[model samples]
Target: MERGKGSPGKAPRVRAILAGGLVLGVGAAITLAAWNDSDFAQGTFTAGSFNLQGSTNGTTFTENPVGSPATLGFTTNPANLSPGDVVTAPFAVRLDGASTYDATVTLSTEASTGSLAGLTYELTQSEDFGCAETVTETLVTAGQTLGSTPASVTFDLAQGAGTDPGAPVNLCFRVTAGAVVQAQTGSTTWEFAAQSQ
Candidate 1:
């Protein structure tokens, strides 16, 4: 039945429905315009670093270099076998970067012949340069038995809070032949590794 001028229970006309749709469309467009907006924001980012390096000798503290057989032999070709001989080598470690870092130094050992029998070693530490105050000297009696284990030291080579970079810590390694060492030829290697936390 057509809904038009009051036949019985009549409803709105087509023109009235079209007018309501037009009003709803206009209202929607006005609401959309009110909510439209724009804004501007900005941010920045940067990076940091912690670089560690070391050296075998003082003048060339670049990276640790292994001692050749010719150097560690401490004697001429086919080095003499004996006891009570002490060999000392000086080394230095540094943080070569623009930031401060908390780090640890550990020692590792290996043997190429006879497993370094009948030998004893000592490691001592001191401040070489740029230490704000004296760091207490440390001595560790790393005997011949500590092979391949990372023996951590009591002292830490901390990069001080000050803005100085390229500061070095000096270490003296003393190796002594045991009094009762056997008359045999052997070789051993030791390494120091530094890690940041």
Candidate 2:
């Protein structure tokens, strides 16, 4: 019958209380968890594009073929010309695509065999029937001789803010055979390329 030792009759109740306390303590130490979830959304992106077009006549433009370059054949090929003869042809360039861009126009001599190399040429941009040297007016300078080493004249193309295919830039080529040009059969090729910036 000591005070520190529980009587035999109360021992079972005390033991039961101690066991319950131990279980409650262990439960408190265990980490509690709840349902967790996450959700996600997907998005897509597309790219823009740039393209150029060329034409001999302002009304008709030819876009570059998907896999090939566009070609602008002279509306009228200059042939059988005598000395002192001057010929002028009209050509045009345009921009076509969803995006707007600064464009560069370049005139490059391809290749030639004959008197065509001896002829001199000048290019002009005309507005309202008045024409100005494209080289002087824009970035390009002077003309090219077909028979000489390959040459290129490049200039920035002017475009309007709202032009869909972009307004056509009217170009005029004045080809002259100097009075002293010798009589010889010759042919030449020239390429005009429009690039986006």
Candidate 3:
């Protein structure tokens, strides 16, 4: 028996048809697939400003930076001291106009010089700029020794609305000289540290 030449040609044609059908099937599957898209998100951040200022006369507020402190204008002469003498001074503090958050002000003694023996002090919150005899609130207890800072003497300051400065907190410091107080020059420096809340 002789093999027919037509059989070989038919097999090649069948293979070519099978291969073309496979390619078309693959192309149709890709075209029928679902369409897709994507989205993204982002954010921006910034920091707010904060500042604290103080005033001795309550009219002109400024930042009393370290090394150059504001001198308190005592009602009595601090240079000339006498027994049973009491001197008082007024101070005011507030958050500056640019501040964006409220804060807490803590009072502490930063430095002391000369002889502070036989001297005591008292601190109070006053209703007005003048350290009046009537006390609105007691911040530091009476009879605290000179050059000594009381623990937990703190006050709160609110942030102002818009560009205006916050309301001022008036403070009064009263110092007394005892009978044993000597004729020596002495000075005490107090610090008002503010923390934003």
- Residue-pair clashes per prediction, in order, are 0, 0, 0
Q: Is candidate 1 or candidate 2 better by lDDT?
A: 2
Q: TM-score, each model?
A: 0.61, 0.62, 0.87
Ranked by lDDT, the better of candidates 1 and 3 is 3
lDDT of each: 0.58, 0.60, 0.89
TM-score between candidate 1 and the true structure: 0.61
> What is the TM-score (0 to 1) of candidate 3?
0.87
Tens-digit lDDT string for candidate 1 (1-197): 46543654434566688889999999999988897678999988675555556665544545445554213323223245357776666666777655467667666664455546666666667666322224347556656442333355534566745665556777666566665346666666765556766
Q: Is candidate 1 or candidate 2 better by TM-score?
A: 2
Ranking by TM-score: 3, 2, 1
lDDT of 2 by residue, 86-183 (tens): 66666667676444676787776556665564577766675422233333343232354544433456656555566466665677666676643555
> What is the alpha-carbon lDDT for the whole of candidate 1?
0.58
What TM-score does structure 2 among the candidates reach? 0.62
> In model 3, where do residues sit more than 4 Å from their true spots?
1-8, 25-36, 180-182
Off by over 4 Å in 1: 1-34, 37-47, 65-81, 98-100, 110-112, 129-135, 142-150, 160-164, 180-183
What lDDT is reached at residue 112 by model 2?
Answer: 65
